[model samples]
Target: MKSGINAIIWEDSANKDYGMQNTGLKSPERTRPHHIAVLAYQGLCLFEFATVMEVLGNRPDASATAWYHLDVCSLEGAQVRATGGALVEATGGREALLSADSIIVPGWRLGPVPQEITSALLEAHAGGTRIASVCTGAFVLAAAGLLDGRRATTHWKYAGTLADAAPAATIEPGVLYIDEGNVVTSAGSVAGIDMLLHLMRRDHGVEASNKVARMMVAPPQREGGQAQFIEHTRPLKAAPAIGAVLDAIRRDPAGEHSVSEMALKAHMSTRTFFRRFKAATGHTPLEWILLERLRLAKDMLEYTDLTIDRIAFEAGFGAGDTFRHHFRRIVGASPIAYRRSFQTV
Candidate 1:
């Protein structure tokens, strides 16, 4: 699985010629062909918007694929200028959205979102269309009120703004993305590529998405969440009562660790330690440790073929079963399943 030959592939003889002449073939007509519409908001990120076009628009023809039909829709038949002063022209406006099987909002520049775009997003969501956003575009989705009470992420730099705008939402500052089924949000800039490719995989299965990734020279997958890249800016002068304990945990996750001992080390009362841990990590002590352990387990799984038992111990889990449980809970897949799917190959 560590080799490059592990790519997943799928092909159908029926769609070999790429045309849907068989009107009676219900599956081909009703399902397979996805109509994707991308909202070309003003001040678009050239790379992010082009990422969608490259993957979905340049799909191979001559074979009957029921491939994607993509439309870049701007407002009122007007050409919206992109960031860095590039002009973008859409074939149509909201009409493209009304007909789309799904809609994507690519990253936008930081500013107030236009009301017209927000209203259309609400209408589409209410109508059962799947909606997603990339980077600052998540701001647009949030502005439309689609992210209320849902877990979402935007660029870490702007996560505070997103949370403030939609207090009903839970803000995950250092994550690649989060999928609340119909509504999904992604983190900063290029992470949008990961979210869109993932949507392709979820809707059309691995093979189709992989093909698109291959064509675009994008990685088929990038796992272990955006937290792996999150910097641990723990202070070095561990003098603060609670700060010392948190820093120690980072250095030795395999060591025996508990709040009582942590409080003792920090020379603080247990109750104070509990309150401060939450303030420090934006989560409970156990929640933070669990994520850290699972993150360690994922690294071992990716880099070595060590058995789950060994990984469990190295990751500081009480047992292999416990490690599997938390890994799946946090990462959304079993360790074995994740390895099979994402291990270098």
Candidate 2:
């Protein structure tokens, strides 16, 4: 095991664990689950809508004892066509906004959001409801002025336009998502899945989030700090060679694949290989290898009942001490603590 590094130990009891305000498991006046309202509009991006539904609507552990209500709402309570031309009827109108505990905007397809929807969003924010947007849906939140002066991110392809439009909002490009307290914004497509999973983790704890992720057949956490597009970094001319090396590294992150070895395999000199590799992957050879290993370690921590040393070895960290050092630096938690936080019965 790698030695000589002191790891910061965090007290689990002192850690902040947030819970939903309205689970509706027991109530004196009425039996009502905490409501999550999704904004449905014409020309909506269907995938993001489906993501919200899949993550929140169908919890595997949900039963008569554990459930949260979902509401599909829009300005007019009418059937709307998706971007692909499929029709969908909403559960209610703008009036539903008043009762929602959290509101989600999947994605805004057509330009010029209706004033009514924007107004409802603003009202909801002013009334202390949590608001989140996926992809171009950040535009809707920006229009409502909910993202003003807050750090946010959107699809990197549209980041420039959103930035130009919302000068007051800090546009952090390339990130998966950004959480600014009550408001959250995510990048394109799958990043939306990460955003909702993050909410589940924050409100219901890691165990609940992991359960939801397993049901979705997806990773429970992909720290919001991760880049939205790692493959785009490669130069077109050198893609095939560098791509092969990257694939190999991913296949065995713990393998001691040195820079010289990778360079020789790619048929490039060490200097050229370093430059080209950095260009294609947005990270240096060492950084990318560590990232992949850490990612594997995180998955093991969440899903497998393995000891820290075994997980470290499987993740290519060689020693439990080395794993602890890198895990603390990247994930901000020790391996044991991270597993403890996400541990399930």
Best by TM-score: 1
Q: Which tens-of-lDDT digit does each residue in 193-311 have in candidate 1?
A: 87777777666566777887887788776544544344445544434766767767778777778878887887778888888777866767777777667767777888898999999
Candidate No. with top lDDT: 2
**Clash-forming residue pairs, model 2:** 233-280, 234-280
For each candidate, give its TM-score against the true structure.
Answer: 0.66, 0.59
1: Cα error in model 1, Å: 46
Off by over 4 Å in 2: 1-32, 223-345
Model 2, 80-116: lDDT tens digits are: 8887788889988877776787899997884887789
Q: TM-score of predicted model 1?
A: 0.66
Q: What is the lDDT of candidate 1?
A: 0.72
lDDT of 1 at 99: 64
Predict model 2's lDDT versus the native: 0.75
